[model samples]
Target: MKLKNGKMRKMMTVSLAATMALGLLAGCSGAKTPVSNQEKVLRIGVLYGGNMDDSYFRQQYTDIYEFDRKNVKIEIVPAINQSDWRYNDGSEPYKEPDYLDGMKKIMTGSNPVDVVVTDVSVLKQLIQENMLKQLDPLVQEDKFDTSDFVPAVIDGIKDLGEGSLYALTPSFSSSALFYNKKLLSDAGVEPPTDKMTWDDVFNLAKRLAKGSGKDRVYGFSFNRYMGNDPFWDMQYTYMAPLQLRMYDEKAETMTVESPQWIKAWDTISNLVKEEVIPNNNNVNYDENWTPISNDMFLSGKVAMMISESYYINEIADANTNAAKIKDYTPVDWDVVTLPTHPEKPDIGGNIYLNNTFAINTNAPNPESAWDYIKFIAGEDWAKLKSRSNSYEMVARKSYIQPRQGLSYNIGAFYNIKPVPPTNPKDDKLKQEKRGLYYVENLGRTYFQEVLDKKKSSTEALKDWSEKGNKMLQEIKLNPKTEFQEDGTPYIPEDNVSAAAGLSSKG
Candidate 1:
């Protein structure tokens, strides 16, 4: 999640800005009927966020629902182990030897949760296997009015089950362009506007980039993992704006080495070699080696960046933490529209949904679980969540409004149409084949080689097209036939870059 600018002299660390791409919170009074006594204790078993007691859960419950309520006792059932929660980034790889084992235990074992929170992908898997309770009947019986929800979000959920509404989200994460107002001011350049093109952003970065040696501050940066996933990479660039997909879902064929993708790779490769954009090493350069994208911008190390809605809360947290060490003035920052592709000036950002809610097919208290899920998605939940500034927008259109205190351009968050998943098997491609990391890793190696001067950008991209084509072909053909993770079908990991015939990190 990153941007462009000019150069001249030494600069002071100023509070930078953050822009998120999602959101939720609010209060409700008129919508629902009273809860029945049988639904007093709501046991929710979250599939991924282990223990179901993370700060996000507690805060939402206590602040919004007011824990220990006279009418309801919300208990996160099926206690999870501290070390078992695993989020597979590239380095660790995606391996789930115990896929849904915990949730299964909750369903079949003595202690179980009535509700579950999991990723959209996992929910889709469950839906396909008929392991989740259908919510349409409940909605109809209660006369639950869902017209307030963002239709795309609701449609996305229904699409997971061929037209069955099996799940929904209280809020979603989004991506946007954030800029340092002071940096642009110092460069004698105007800050980014809501309609800047990619070239426009790069030029701004060049103008704001200044100094040399250790004092050198490059013009732009980004979220470190952008290039590691094909779908995400496309979303972050040209293909998404035009609604292009690498794989044709209807035909079930791979469409790689295209003009749009190739041109994007060429453009990005040149930028890296010129040092217009920082490498992975620089972007994640914290001494502690933690994931701190916001700190780089917050400390004025970079002028602009892309970030999820969650970064807004991070900005507030970092400022509060820094204030304890000494009095520190926050950097002035704001947001603009994300850069647009010249080919598709009308398009803006590629919006992706993160977390969602579903019920176990064997849920003992499905009604109560429905109540909890409905409450979270209802107007009251959105009203309360809005004030938290967590960046996740409620899935409702009316609740999607500006934060009370922030002065940035909030419209950028919703100005563009979202790039939805193009294929039903997109998630399967990402997980089963580790296709995300594979293509991402391959492209990254070749792209970075250009920056290292080991190869020309032309040479790298040509190699990329060929090797990427081969990989996409295998990925398209490989079927999720077996449940065994190790014996899965995918292009075997290679020890060298097939394009340059050099040893690779893969």
Candidate 2:
């Protein structure tokens, strides 16, 4: 991808929570053991993850999962969805029946699935059903040194029980704040600083947003999230930046009604009302152009956006595409650190795991499955993954540097800690078990009311909190709700203003 700086780099590695995976699966793994010509083939199950068409799954399938070995032949079974109920970020709850039923068949069928390359919701549901193997045994037996694995990578795979290790991630995805230099300058607003607070950022956004209706400019927007799991954008980009969460797992309660949470909602509400950040309704994609229009950042209709590094490629291609069309000028943009809270001025936005791998316990070849998971999640694979077009950085620290030279704040991405889950581990399961579809389909209704001006922010959140709590109460009553505790983001500098330094670098 050619950046404004004219440096070409392959970009858009994201598709995670939006990036990791293979050069080809041939020599990426070191676990291939010699086997006779008659060696049995290892069958692997690949599930539906985000952006399947251009995702890490495609890379991993070609590179690591489908990796070839002299003695051991490998066969991959791409998960087939017989039903139309996809995990579009909890958007369709009624479809859960079709989804769960399909997955159960895959794991427990006559020809059972082995290792899986899947999204978080699939892994979470598998773990809840005790359908996955405890990988500690394999890790110990293989003497796999997992110390190199990123802490958050491990945390994301913890099961509801003792939070045991049941899954592992091969790559890491995160968000950074992208700004339009022309918009900022035109508004007479200085470019944002790396350590700027949300309040300060919002003020800049308001100033940069101008015009009326169709030709108007927006202050902020983001890349479309995996529809399967939607609320993350709200949590990671909005609330977590302020050190807030919708639910407090440790307390076994909902935090959606808290003052901080309310303020977070109102802040967004006010932005929508003031037309700084247009509501989702106003962001329309041209059917001919599809995502580009709705992707306001690339549409060049937004001044600032919280986007995964994947855009590092998309934006570049956007310019090329724009030049081919009539009357479209390329977006003049650069990036800075994501906005931080006044109190937690140094943290980065929430980080998400990408290409996370897991094994099904009922598989006939659990050992082989473990081998595949470890190989892809280990160092050898990391080397190739780092260089891929993934927008997300690989988990390996050494691989986490900016591509040779395109002029963007690559450091801004690594500048902070990720926000960890605050709820009880079991509660986390209860939500995922139901697909968080309820939260997405139901909760968002009330939240949208506030955005549409039909209900006050406080009133909307309070109502959702009450209704959401009742749903949780019913979920907790399920026999599978037993489980326990577990774990859980950036920035810096001289008084010269980190934002200023970022602008200079740009």
Candidate 3:
């Protein structure tokens, strides 16, 4: 996971890709003597989260590179930045740029890269700009089995066209309702069920928050940091599943003003008004609300919280004054699906909205890069990658089934069953909590606008529709074009250019 190690591995992959391209180009051009092995080296650009040692990101990059090296020669040049550069851009010159800045570096860097890997927000921007190479050729060549990947993940990678696929998502995170089993049992409350509605959750919240003043224990803790914090979390967890569509796919419009959205807003507002959940100010004090919520629950101060499944380990390990979580040996906490709206049974899990991989349009070795892409998304790599990260869920449906020789029992955490033996558990909680239906940042804004009471649900939806359409229009109309020093436009299919810009919207 070390940054240096990642950088080294990236260099190796990029070098190999370059080597493969040189040899391939020689034969295609009918050169008498093919290019020597020394001339072949491929460059790949990658922007990773956290440090190079970040288990999930590191394992992903390493697994793919190692797996592909045996079959193809390639080098991966990774630009690993520990700090997020986007946030630091305007405010602090000394600090790192946030996610966007980091992505731009990988996309527009001087080095010749065959593939670029990063998050959806960055990939979406590249896609809009037509910076990514269409992966249909690779798919047709049978380099990878696209059908093995989950439908939701495939949908995420495809453009509007039926055959177009631009990227691949290997893993992602989702939300779940985590509850302290002992506390719920002590209160004589039936553990939450997957079938529970928001109203049912509210009743439990009211019962859990019975004590007054200092002795009071709230039902849930949530943050409201405009777009990133509780705003998005609540939207994905509470609003979207209510069948509130933020944007109309066909019309390319926002629908924030819908009555369903209004109901969602009013429900959250009521919770705040009744003190069932902490207000925005209280929750915002902590940078990340999950830890605070975990602490509160582990300490026997809160009854339940909605959080990422990865937090289960932290909660089970945390120390608390009311009851030492560790002394209980193995913790007795359980996950439940986030409450659903009465009318929206189909709506549940959020989709993966994190880092995905795309071929750079200008990559020197497209074929070999596709090979690596296939390897990364293949069964061998998927199984190895799954064992390396606790937070990530493999996007391939085949990999989701039980696998032997894994370092940990990952299936145990994901194949969770509901408590109290009520009907078939269906493992809905695990599915929903595995990056199944994520709301975008723009979607989050609509939720915030509604929650803040600044706009009616209908009005918010209208605004979102306008903004989303405008953005999509800008992307479609402004096709990205690479140019030469002579100022002539460069078409990707006919020309090879060292300098190119990949553009797409988040």
Q: How accurate is candidate 1 locally (lDDT)?
A: 0.59
lDDT of 1 by residue, 144-237 (tens): 7788776556776787789889887877656678887888898898888887888889888888787654445667666423223322353455
Q: Which stretches of candidate 3 lie over 4 Å from their true place?
A: 1-39, 47-60, 63-112, 146-148, 159-164, 195-197, 223-237, 240-262, 280-294, 318-330, 341-345, 348-351, 397-506
Q: Candidate 3, after superposition: displacement of residue 272 in Å?
A: 2.1
The candidate scoring highest on TM-score is 1
Ranking by TM-score: 1, 2, 3
Per-residue lDDT tens digits of candidate 2, residues 115-202?
Answer: 7665555556667788878888878887876776655456545633357888777776766788888878888989987767888888
TM-score of each: 0.65, 0.64, 0.57
Q: Give the TM-score of candidate 2.
A: 0.64
Q: Which ten residues in a row have the lowest lDDT in candidate 2?
A: 483-492
